[model samples]
Target: MKIYLAPMEGLLDHLLRDMLTRTPGVDICVTEFVRVSGSLLPNRTFQRIAPELLHGSRTPSGVPVRVQLLGSDPACLAENAAKLAELAPMAIDLNFGCPAKTVNRHRGGAVLLDEPELLHEIVSSVRRAVPAAVPVTAKMRLGYNDRTRMLDCAHALTSAGAAELVVHARTKADGYKPPAYWHEIGRIREAVTVPVIANGEIWAVDDYVQCQLESGCDDVMLGRGIVADPGLAARIKGLPAPDWDAIKPLLAAFWDDVLIYILPKYQAGRLKQWLNYLKRIHPEAGIAFEHIKTVKDADVIGAWLAEGCPVPAAEPGWTKA
Candidate 1:
């Protein structure tokens, strides 16, 4: 089974992608969506979102990274995909699953699901424009507001030449709610000829098992789950889970990487954002975040982590959803 890292906007940037792809069982990493508008974007824009494009489109550990594009316009998406293909990424993934209001307001993400033909046109245009050796894929929610016409949408994407399809198992209106509707993916898989990857709310190995059983798809993609437990992908692949001590070095490495790549003013917030997710899995992370949540100084945060933020004997249960 292929385990992919979901492209979460604002969270799964290239820094985190580099970190997670180093872990075992992460087959591929998808960069956060590069928003396409009226015109072709410059090469610098693609490089900014996926700097790995400079180094054979693979993470430091040699895991492939696919560039994902989000837009509604067929010609513009094709133009951007053609330009990005020149960079030789592992694959091109089209984003039809984003639920952010800002993205939808601009006719960019899940909102396009309301018109299956539009989704087909956009995907087909990108598929034809890029080299045939470069695979084109699409990720989509069940629908815009409901599951009706979901089969139509699935068939539309496959007929449009998407090499693979990832179904997030919820409509745009569902918006990250409980019960990811994994069984719904089974329907899409049956309808389409292309491979379907299941994604949504897979937080643990048990959840991964259940998602596969329910969706009947061999491939799975993880998002927030990896943040809550950095060793989750390793665990899913039957590797030993990283204990608190093992996790500390990764946190330090992440801090160092962010400090080097990101500007000073934004570094602390990125660390804090990761801590917020880490708190769900480790007691030490909770204590660390509480103490430095308001601190904007990355140096101070680094000092605290370097000092070994005291870990209590017992950790709180994972709660965030």
Candidate 2:
């Protein structure tokens, strides 16, 4: 019955994490992956990426936010994991499922799946480095280009001391396409004794139910689906859907939080990134975004999101795509 929010690189920063965790049914929020290289990451960089760790490693509303690290080098990755463990977030999550071109080109993320022994080394090194009380979990796809070694990879990670595994159910080649191949996750769940969390192509309540039923997993991690529907996780848990009017106020409140917390420090590009997701809830919100499309100043974008977007209807099922 656990629900973890997937750590989407650009999409699930602190602003969105704060807003979503405020809604019902969210338990864990994994921060975006911190790319590790030859040495320990700068403490300032880790703090900026996951300031919630300062607030007790939890969301403002108190849901725990786990820190995630991405890298392929066993030694360096393990070193960074140790430092992150010192900071002490709820858990340390390893990212082996990112399919982004740059990460794959660097032999990090999902591309590491190509070599099962290497994946084992990476996971085991970090798992042993981190404190025993702090769980070290991993997220990964089936493979890079084929499904030939999916189950074996899952077994490798679990045997290497990964507390749990989140399977995105697609190979690196699938690249976020529809039909997330949930069956593959089911297969992985059957193969591993560690907890398996299913991810990908989950956009609605039925999708959540089907994922759990099909994968035989006790938990599900949501990404783009929750982005499209702010109240989605709540709805999937059978909570009353926020009326359009109620949600509009909440959105406005969320914008206020964004303006107060994120705008002054980050780029205007981040504002647009958030609006693109908000558009899924309030299509009209895009109009406000269009007005500021050419504006590069973060202050201006924050102003627009705060003052420009029209109030959305409060009734459920307000508009259809």
Candidate 3:
């Protein structure tokens, strides 16, 4: 069974990719969607968003990272895929699963599920543009506002040459709600000959097991669940869970990476975001979050972390992404 780290816009950048992949069971990661509109994006844009491109499209942990593109235009998306192909990504993934209103309002993401023909055109055009050796895959929700056309949309993507598909198991209307309809993914998987990876609302080993039993998919992609517990995939694969002591150094290393990669103003929010997720699995993380929830200066947070902030002595020498 393959375990993939789901591409989460805004939250799952290369920094977290490196951090999360440090454990076990995470086979591949899709970079946060690189929005393509109007014309072909510069190679630097892909590089800036996914510097792993410069490292043979692999994260610091050596896990392969595939570049994902998001847009509505078939021809324009194709042209950009050709450009990104020059970088030799593991696979070129199209984004039809993002449910952000701004993305949907602009005719990107899950809204396109309403038009299976358009989805077909976009996937076919890009498949033709990219080298055949490089697989073209896609991720999508069950539908836009409903699951009425879920199977039709799955067939559309597969018939258009999408090598594999990931079904998020809910409609855009679901909006990250509970009770992801994994059975819906089973229906889509049965309809399509290609591999189907199940995603959405999987927060534990039990959830993973249930998702597999319900979706009939062995490969599963984890989203916020992995963020909440960096070692989630490892634990599901039967590795022992790291206690709070093991998590503290990652926080320090993450903060270190944030300082170098992001501006000082945005750095605190980055740490806070991970801490917020970590709080779900670590009580000390909850205390740390409370200590720095209102604090803006990253230096202050660093000082608090060095002093242990309830879970002290973050060991140094974490590999930076």
Candidate 4:
């Protein structure tokens, strides 16, 4: 199975991607979307979002990282893609799955699903702009407000030369709710010729098993699921899973990176955001989060972490969903 790490805007960036891919079983990762509005963005813009481009489009762990672009204007996207291709990314991915309101108001994301023809134009345009060796992929929701045009969108993307597709299995209206409608992904998989990677609502190993059964897709793209449990992908492949003892050092290393890269004011929030997700798997994470939830000083939090911030055994059966 090809397990990909999803591009979570504001949540997963290059630094976090580096740390997460250190574990085995993560094959590839897609960077967060770079909004292409009108003009061709400078090389720095692409490099800023995905510094891995400067390092052969691979993370520190050596996993290839694909750059994702979000926009509606076909010509503009093509121009930006061509300029970005100069940096030699592993691939270029289109973002048709974002559900944010501001993005939709600008006619950028899932809202574009209503017009499959436009999706075709955008994908085909980018495909022509980039080199043949660099693949073009796309991620999309079932639809904008409903699933009426789901298959039409899928067919349009593949026909326009999308190498692969990642379907989130929910409409824009669903908005991160539980029960991600994996059955819908199964239908799309049957309809599309290229590989279909199932996404959405996979939180644990059991969820991954059930998603594979329901979606009938061997490939899966993980977002919050892997972020919450770093050992999730390894567990799926029956590799050794990292316990709390393994996580302690990671937490400290993460804090060090945060201090160096993130602004002093927002550094605390970044660590807390990750810890909030970790709480879902390890109770010890919840304790760590609570201890620093109200503390804003990075040094103070760093001190707490240096003291070996909570490392208790995971609760019995924490490995399962």
**Cα lDDT computed for each candidate against the true fold:** 0.88, 0.81, 0.90, 0.91
Kindly list the per-residue Cα lDDT of model 2 for residues 220-290, writing each as its tens digit: 89888887677788888888665444555555666566656664545555656666776767665576456
**Clashing pairs counted in every model:** 0, 6, 1, 0
Query: lDDT of candidate 4 vs native?
Result: 0.91
Candidate 4 lDDT for residue 151: 97
lDDT of 3 by residue, 85-114 (tens): 999999999999999999999999999999
* Local accuracy of candidate 4 as per-residue lDDT tens digits, 116-140: 9999999999999989999999999
TM-score, candidate number 3? 0.95
RMSD of each: 4.4, 5.1, 4.2, 5.1
lDDT leader: 4
Task: State the lDDT of candidate 1 residue by residue for 53-140, as single tens digits.
Answer: 9999999989999999999989999998999999999999999999999999999889988999998899889999999999999999
Please rank every candidate by lDDT, starting with the best.
Answer: 4, 3, 1, 2
Better of 1 and 4 by TM-score: 4
Model 1 steric clash pairs: none
How does model 2 fare in lDDT? 0.81
TM-score of each: 0.94, 0.88, 0.95, 0.95
